[model samples]
Target: MFNLYFISQSTCSILLLLNFALKNVACNPVVRTKSGCLKGSIDRNIDGGKFYQFMGIPYAEPPVGDLRFKAPKPKHPWKGIRNATEEGSACPHRREKRFNQSVPLVGDEDCLFLNVYTAELPRNSATMKLKPVLVYIHGGGYVFGNGGRAKYGPKNLMTEDIVLVTLNYRLGILGYLSFSDPTLEIPGNAGLKDQRLALRWVQDNIRRFGGDPNRVTIDGESAGGSSVHFHVISPSCRGLFHGAIIQSGSTLNSWPWGKLDGAISVVNKIGVKAKTQKEALDVLKSLSAYELVRVLEQMGITECSNDWQDISPVIEYPHEGAFLTKSPIDILNAGEQNQVPLILGYNSKEGHWMNYQQMAAKAMGTWVAPFSWECIIPWQTGIKKGTAKSKRFADTLERTYQTETPEENVVNAWSDSIYDVGIEQAIKFHLKTHLAPIYAYRISVITRLNYLKRSLNLWDKPGVFHSDELGYLFSQSITPKVSPGSPEDIYRRRIVKLWTNFVKYKNPTPDDELNVLWQPVESVDPIKQLDIGENLTFVDTPEARRFVVWNELLEESPFIIN
Candidate 1:
């Protein structure tokens, strides 16, 4: 239990560099960042170890008004010790009015902030020992999500003696929409630049919070995983972090930068149109963020899932001041970026959730149509009756996945269809090009205490979802919390040890504690996969049941050209 003490809000005064000292500290944790001094609260009831949490600290100035659709600027220095103990607003996003119905987009535009959780502060940068750092990015298809969710609380992970950081960035049209213009007015990848600025803040200020800048690890799930993948290849972000953990995502996921010209033509049909590209840019800038996001949502739902390509990171021309200079495949093949230890993998039953989604959409058939959730194809649209293109796609899909239930087959086929072309291909390419350790995993565990199932009227169902690993490591920070004897408690420790081990040292397997020796895939071995489930096992990466058929069809058909 913490010995309770309080730092008066009225008494905080600016301290000069010449007179700065830790002697005047109260029970709360106070550290001076490059931009300003921050005061945070101490937790008394954390099971493993009580820690300090500095919440909603501004890393960048609000990206509103003239700064919209541009790279972030560092927060200007404050005059007094700023309080950083509350959560900040999340980026703007669109929500479905109903299960397949069009809805108005909603969120705030001034949502660029980061949070930090640590055990203690260093008096001086030179003499103090520091711990490894972990920065997490949340995923919602680069369209919807926030970093400060309650489930992402770092109270449990900090027990392993590492610093935890999470951040928010621009989303939807404000973040990823780009056009082919003579002037690079809407320089894409502003969201990624927001992330890069947050990393820079950590590098410059984390030392004061007892984190080593040289030992930082960037970790993310889903689209956030893809963001980390882009950072690995980004030239502007060299040396920003030392390691990466990408779960259930890759650069090839959803948006793989083929041709945006087709997408730009689509953009012109519905949105505020003007005669010239410059006029279009001016018209777009004139619209409010909410209006812009609503228009993008409408457009996204109208197109087929595969061709909804306008809402992701882009391959900018050289010296264009964008995040990715070339495409992800181009960069990975050329080997022209930072090299770091990486832990990447996908969950078992990733497509099970997609199947459920399809079923739900059908059951609620009365709900409005054209409800497009990014990254998920509709249950009925793959087999449209019109063109040869549709027939080829449908025929190949039918051949690839055949089962008792045709609907379920389509659902199960999603895993390989999505990953085989995305994560799986990226990993195979990475092994050939990079010599750094590559530890791939497949998480197949189904939790007994799945809260979503019970709360959402889905009972007795068992499946490991795309983001199910998150609950074991990051519990909902609330009452009736996970108990010490529960499976969640046990797995939390095991998972944290594996991840922090990779951060502290360049290996996931520990030297002292008992752990499965997760061996890295070598040049000779095409597959050495770690399976984390009810029991941990290392097995040959089994070829997906649908791989052969899918591969043959993709090679033969002209529908799905790379």
Candidate 2:
């Protein structure tokens, strides 16, 4: 009453402070990671509840300049809050077939990023339980996949009491090039190292996002699935994840490991001195990231080898950072790896996805695309295309698995070689070595929306092509232009329920939701394989006959199948 103006100023100051306090309260979901404080946006669930969404969070420093082709370094800590709202750039890769070759491509070199999705929290609730975590590594044959794609939204997945995490690592040349030097200089599998670092990041900071670090599960499909297999054996990933879900990719697959010469040849074609590794390294270091990728593209050789290999993970040279010094099959056969719960399985028609016409073209001496099978080694092994040795291998393939037609034979060869046989070997080895709960399933569900039905010829009358389960799993993996709640949608829900139940509870069979029981893989049980479809039908291992031929070949050969 004595000083009205002073009273008004004091009131304004109080209002200002109240506004600031409210702002801080509104940002209650902010997470304090080891790197820095992150301010993520919130999204409304289908149930009209809000959940924290942290996107484009840097897990490792950008693999640029000196960091390129080297193991990933942890990201430095920041002083202030980082806005993690947008998705990160995908690692550099060759865009699939295009009409215009002249146009500049997409992707970036600074792509070591991860995203986290936490379930909706109640207002001012401290009793909320930490959720189980699933960190997924995207697969594109170690060449062309990004974790931030629109199709992989965590909306449906997050509905369960699970924290979903997805991440990107280096790909193709920047990821898989092996200098093959003993000094650990350019030790191959940098991409895999990137994945390791991302896992470390999750282990370090997932708790801040209300995730139980101890209950982390690593999962992937195709190349991503192989990555999961590698983690199972990698010492660096020992305590990072508890359970692994390998879908449609066996590390023992004919793919994944790049031939030593093939990686060198890729570097040589980039206008580098082919005389020595040092010279090649010098030239590679001097070129810009985009320039290097462009040169690789113009050369018309996909990655290091053909699509089957294409410069993926390789046994690292014996050194400090060596993740794998010998073949994974040898180590697993000897029972040397981190013992953990595992769910290993493959799609119904994992091999029918590859084009028979394209393979026939390459075998018939036509260069259809950059990654044709011509550059392959063991099928020829620098012995020239028409040599007797090459012919013998091809002839052996025909005799190994007799099919209706040559085209069918080619598709079947790819199917068995790339996925079925390899998976069988891994399963057989797992049975021999580890006694932990190892469950294997044959995903024989015939979906209404078969991805490969229209794309590739169905000479084999395959029930489901590779990655058809992805549509039922991830909302965005495939789009059939059909609305949800179809037969496929119901199956998708069933698949998700089973998968998430495994994550929440170790055994997928014990869940009370469905009366189905997915038993652990066994030698005596003929109907151990879980056939996931409209109804749960227990069937014998579907790929038994194919494995018989493959087991014999794998046992005799010292070198891995090429």
Candidate 3:
């Protein structure tokens, strides 16, 4: 009897393996990208359907050595088969601290790679019915993030029947910092240029991977959202993609506008003197990529610093087929953008993270005291400019940060001035300019079991913090604390349905079978917030009180125009 049972179990196991293999086509090969023929795989998941996967396809030539700061050019065609089975290396490191331990890994300079995933499994000689493509740009405030970051893997979206693409762009000094020395002509925003090149690559060759070239939807969170905002009006990016989804980011946020001057300042601080423009460019091109990264990292301003006026894409004259608007607001006002369907919104607890950090610093008694009492060199340096603007900003902050105490007030003020005001300005401007259908929402899920399980939180602070909503869309990049299984999981399913429907039909509202008809966002009406709490409801006007406060502040301040 034992022998018979063993034989029967072996037979059953073989049959099961056969069934699984038949149901899923793993790593199928295709011949249609700019980089020659490549292979991909397919699999099924609990939430999504069959998914076709392509990993580490070269989107641009490796930006290494002298090519480091220049806008990425097209990758040269290869002769032999290129291995794309594994994810390509990530760009140089930026800090990501969790629970007081550093997470370090190997990264490379030649990291301009992308991954593609699709729901359709195209058989030989059988055409795949074109599906809407949703290209996601990951957020790390434009300084530190990788498309390879596990939390943002495209598996879930692929199963939802949307073609998904994620690519790595230049970051930190390599991507953003410009050497002002007259010798350097390549100047600023190599990173932003890298993103443009990737989109161009997609426009040129996504159809072969079962994606509709014409139905591409670009989306991002945080800095990624900022990039989407930049691309909207870029002349070089015209007709490259259709539709955009901006989350938790907007135009009114502090951006690095003066590319050439900003680059000069950064390079000068790093001890590079430019006698002439060409000499400056030659010196910059000579520095090793790793040496530059190491030097910038030691400056203490490397990671966790998004200098409002020193670290972003700037308006540049069109050259080599690359062009971008001066600012997002300018594009909206002119209506010169792609004018594709858009879904723009932000989280309800957007500013809580920064507010909490300030509070924590105060509790530890390590808070750097205000500058009014001190003007010594300890707080002032030639590289750092302390102007009337800084003084005014400090005085205003000191006044508005009022809470139970001085410490409490500082935290409140930071949150209000930064995240709150910034997001409000962009949304209001978008509403004022364009007439296309727009959908907006406020994410308000705090401490749900399922969501927390799949996120990366720094301090256990509650509420949907920045990029916290990302996990609801993919299984990658899960926080160690959040466990699976809860009512919170349902939110992800609902969101994927909404987003895919939007990409497919240019509307976030679902059909009869999907059972939800999300109304379009209105300028006067209160937001139909997606409260991810237990037994969620559509509030008449979510955060009505806060909106009034922000709007009132905007009217008083010259910076924000309602």
Candidate 4:
């Protein structure tokens, strides 16, 4: 009898192990996309919320060889199941570094991929109710950034019942180089075209992943945010998305848009001695991706400058597949944009991250004040440098935000000119023209989760720095782990809820769970904005005095403020 019992127990153990193996096999989910079948991995959030992740899914064919400078082509159908368990290579660009550290260029030319995270999959496509979708565009000044899981993990966001998608587009010179000679066929905004293709992929395949095709919202920050606003104005992107979340960026921002002069300067700096644009195109195409990036880096080319970026969105000559043929301002002024529900805002101290070194130098008593503040005037204002108009604008800015210390004045000036003024202008225009609800906000919440500031050792510094709000919305590997019920965790939950709620209802405050009634901008006289901090409060005309100063200074300027 004892021998028999021992044999039975061993048999039961073997059966249990086999059952677990089968369960493990079941956990690897498969979803059918229009291109082919994709096998993905499963993950759990911090709170044990289970979700499915499909990574490294190609949305476009490799933009290589002859396709280098051209717009992305739609991905062709594959033969069998593609393994999407791993992330695709990042687009070709130099990795972002701190304090100007030189990092190795990482990624490949065939990097037009996207990732999808969903809490549930449709068991029966005819009966299951699809969830709303949020497609995120990463912000790296349109120079560096990818939709990989390491930085933009879905742990925080997947807890909500929504489908989240993040994607990669071409960046830097490869993405934005343009020429007036349309014969070369390298109309700029190929990166934006990549994004549009990804969105089209979502519209076609998201339903199979349990996402509603009709209820898709596009969200992005910084350059990505500006990209969203660009989509709002671009005719090519009409009907691609139903809603938008523009964080700390706007089409009105001068830095993101440029003209042919800037493009010509980049070519000249690259030592391309082409008499014609076609010759320049051939030279650029012959160079390796790494070589192009290396030359640009040696030339000190970066996404951000007081002037337009060396590589940036430009008005393309009218031709087939031209992404943007006219000025975005003209599009908005003519009310010819894709009007959609929008949630747009900026961090309280958007320039703190940009001027942290200056702040540190001042703290050490080694700071030297600039002799002339004329450089503080943004180039978008179109007021010629050293002119009376430029000097007057500079003087007014100095008087408006100048404090006893030069560091404070510098931060304020940079913040207003780079972010605040443009965002406020966007809000004003939306309120005056669009019938859709436009919710404007200013995030002033200072906490340990202020990722950018804390990473730069500026946590002790005053005000929330640019991209500080990212920590609360997405779970990144670099951020500190949040204790279950801590204030930081609560803040994270609050932010994620607000954003996902907007994704679901198009109104952040659909209910009173958070105890705040977030309202939309109704009038430009006193632009109503939600101040998101320890407590959500409705403030009338954020930084009104400073905006008034900017308004009067740029009243007669050619750049579009109205």
Per-model TM against the reference: 0.85, 0.83, 0.79, 0.91
Q: Please list the Cα RMSD from the true structure of every candidate, rounded to 1 decimal place.
A: 5.1, 6.5, 8.0, 6.8
lDDT of 1 by residue, 1-562 (tens): 5211133323344332322464344455666777877778776324756678888888999998778877788999775577777878888775422234454455688899889988766657788889999999987677777787465778667777888899998886677656666364565777888999999999998997889999999999877888898898888899999999988787766543333323354357565456665665566677788776665555533223354355667765554456776656567777775789889888755665555555565665532133222223321123234457555655666655566365455445566555434566567668768768888888766554333343344545445665777765564533236677677666666777788899889798867473578888774334567888766687554334444454454445312212
**TM-score winner, 2 or 4:** 4
- Overlapping backbone residue pairs in candidate 1 total 0
Which residue runs does candidate 3 get wrong by more than 4 Å? 1-28, 98-105, 124-127, 179-183, 255-259, 270-283, 301-309, 355-416, 447-460, 477-485, 512-516, 524-544, 560-562
Q: Model 3: how large is the Cα RMSD against the reference?
A: 8.0
Q: Candidate 2 residues 71-98, lDDT tens each? A: 9899997655566778988888654321
lDDT of 3 at 304: 17
- Please name the candidate that would achieve the greatest TM-score relative to the true structure: 4
Clashes of 4: 0
**Lowest lDDT block of 10, candidate 3:** 373-382
> In model 1, what is the error at residue 313, expressed in angstroms?
1.1
The order by descending lDDT is: 4, 2, 1, 3
**Model 1, position 124: C-alpha lDDT score:** 71
1 or 4, which is superior by lDDT?
4
Query: Which is superior by lDDT, 3 or 4?
Result: 4
